[model samples]
Target: MKIGIIGSGMVGRAFSIRLAELGHDVLIGTRNPIITLGREEPDSKGIPAWKFWSLHNPEIKLATFQEVADFGDVIINATAGAISIEALSKIEKDSLKDKVILDLALPLSYSPERSPKLIYSNEDSLGEKIQRAFPESKVVKTLNTMSYKVMLYPSLLPRQHNAFISGDSEEAKLIIAKIMEGFGWESKDIIDLGGIITARTTEMYAPLLFQLSKIKGHYNINISVVSK
Candidate 1:
């Protein structure tokens, strides 16, 4: 299976390496592949993003957003929440038509006092906005409620935790659920919240997740859904 991931950041890289290792062809989508590949010294993480990819996951390729849009069988949007819509606008509408898109972004912004605020809330959501923008694309919202590591490897922690999938297409949700199962998530652990509109609940969890991480001093924690 060919997978195209938008955004070359850590989240994108994590998904790329993991999926590629699982035997799927992965292409990272970016605005400028050349600039990203030619980037200088590493950031605070100590390894340049491109170098990290070249060294650790050479199997995963990089390309422009358009190329990736045209290349993938299923597209994964790992772009930042703030610029997700803008990034999606770069891809050709026809390229995304009838394809399954796994949207893993949260629309978050900071207030003047540096407090986190949701860019979209209440009646509106980023997932709904994306669905509205690309009506032909089958969009499923998931994996935005936890760290990239946890998203890819749920078994890293001993206890069982919950993951979510939301979209109008049951087939799309089933496809994503299988991918999650491949990533070590139990079938029962994945909850289908039903419809794209439910994406608002998952995306809205970002602030609480961040706050819990800040308080706990780690990103290892996750949500554990207890059903009655």
Candidate 2:
């Protein structure tokens, strides 16, 4: 599958590398194309440089937002929640028409002291808002319930974790589920919590993940769904 990932942050870069490793044609969209060139060093976060070195497929090119929207068979929105709409707005509406967008962003807004909080509430979610804005695009919300480290490679961990996907489009959800399975996630491990309305619950997990990251001093944990 030809996949386009917007945002060059940890999540975006991580997914690009993993998907590329899995033999998928991956294109990364970033504000600055130089980052993909690997000319400069990475920040203290240890993400940017690592991704550049780890990418096995040189075919994974850095492209403009519009190029990504046009090039992808499936578009993955990995941008920060506050800027997700802004980023998508820059792309020509027609370019994303009838496309499947796998949304992994959270509705986070930054304040003075706090890190970020969900700008949306229980009544609405980022997924619904994006779907409303791009009615022609099928948006499936998934992979927001865990950290970037666990998003693709979970078997390395001691226990298996669960991920949730929600969207009104059954066809889109099935495609996302198959993609997830390719990335080392098991079918039984992923929960399809009905349509996009359930995205509120999935989005809410972001704040909880933030709190847990603070408590554990790590962002590599996962949420396991265990049946009794």
Candidate 3:
């Protein structure tokens, strides 16, 4: 499977390497290839520049946002929540036609006082916005509530945890669910909360997840749905 992932940051690199290791052709997309490749140092977040990371993993390739979107069988949005739509909008409408968009981004932003909050949550969600923006494509939301490490390596925690997926297209959801399975997520561990609207709750989990991470001093955590 050819997978195109938007964003050349840690999240995108994590998925690119894991998926390529799984025998899938992966391409990571960024805004400016020349500029991104020129940076020798890490960013404000301390993530290594794309050029350095690209050297270690030559199997996975890089391209501009639109180019990767056109090359992929399925497009994964690994971009930050604040600019996900802008990044995706770079792709032409025809390229997105009937394509399954696996969205795992949240609309996170900080206030003037540097307080964390969701740009769109509760009443609306980034998944719903992506669906609306690209009506021709099927958008499925998942994995936004957890860390990228846990996303590809669910077994790292060693427990019966769960991942949530929501989309208007059942077929699209199934496709993404299969990919999640490839990442070592058991079939029973994946929970489908119905249509794309359910992303409201999933994306809304960011604040709580962040709080928990702050308290624990680690981002490695999982959500388990217990039942009788």
Candidate 4:
């Protein structure tokens, strides 16, 4: 499978490297590949993301966003939530037609008090917006509830944890679920929250996730749902 991932941030890089390692042909989409590859300063991880990926996972290729849209069979939107719309706008909606899109972006805003606020709350959600924007795309909201590390390697936590999926298309969700299972997530670990509207619930969890990280002293935690 050829996977096109938008954004070269940590999430995009992690997904790219892991999927490439899993034998998928991966293409990382960026506004400017040259600029991304030329970065000298390190990111939060203390090394340039492109440089690290090139050295460690050279199988993944870098290309313009348009090229990514053309190359991918399945596209993953891992861009920052705040600029997701702007980033995706560069690609023609027709180019994304009928493709399954795994949307992991969460719209978050920080206040002067330092508390995070949801840009799209109960009335709206980034997932729904994306679906509306690209009516032909099968948009599934997922992987927003956990960090990049925990997303691909849930077993690192030792305890069982859950990930949520919300989208209008059952087939699209199934495709994404298979990918998640390939990443070591059990079938039960994936919970389909029903339709893209429910993305509001998952997207709203961002603030709580940050609070939990502060309380737990690490970002390597996830929610485990138990029901009979």
**Can you give the TM-score per candidate against the true fold?**
0.94, 0.88, 0.97, 0.94
Q: What is the alpha-carbon lDDT of model 2 when measured against the actual structure?
A: 0.85
Question: What tens digits encode model 4's per-residue C-alpha lDDT throughout 99-169?
Answer: 99899988977666886778879899999999999999999999898888999998989888899999999
lDDT of each: 0.88, 0.85, 0.91, 0.89
* Model 1 pairs in collision: none
Residues 100-194 of candidate 1: C-alpha lDDT, one tens digit per residue: 99999888886757547898898988899999999999999998888889999998888989998899999989989988888999998999999
Task: Please give the lDDT score at residue 162 for candidate 1.
Answer: 93
Model 2 regions more than 4 Å off: 32-57
CA shift of 109, model 4, Å:
1.9
Candidate 1 residue 52 Cα shift, in angstroms, is: 5.0
Give candidate 3's whole-model lDDT. Answer: 0.91
> Which model scores highest in lDDT?
3
Give the 10-residue window scoring lowest on summed lDDT in candidate 1: 43-52
Tens digits of lDDT, candidate 2, 53-170: 5465465577888889899989999998888998889899899998999999998888779967889878999998899888999999998887777788877668878899999899
Higher-scoring candidate on lDDT, 1 or 4: 4
lDDT, model 3, position 161: 93
Residue 203 displacement in candidate 4 (angstroms)? 0.7
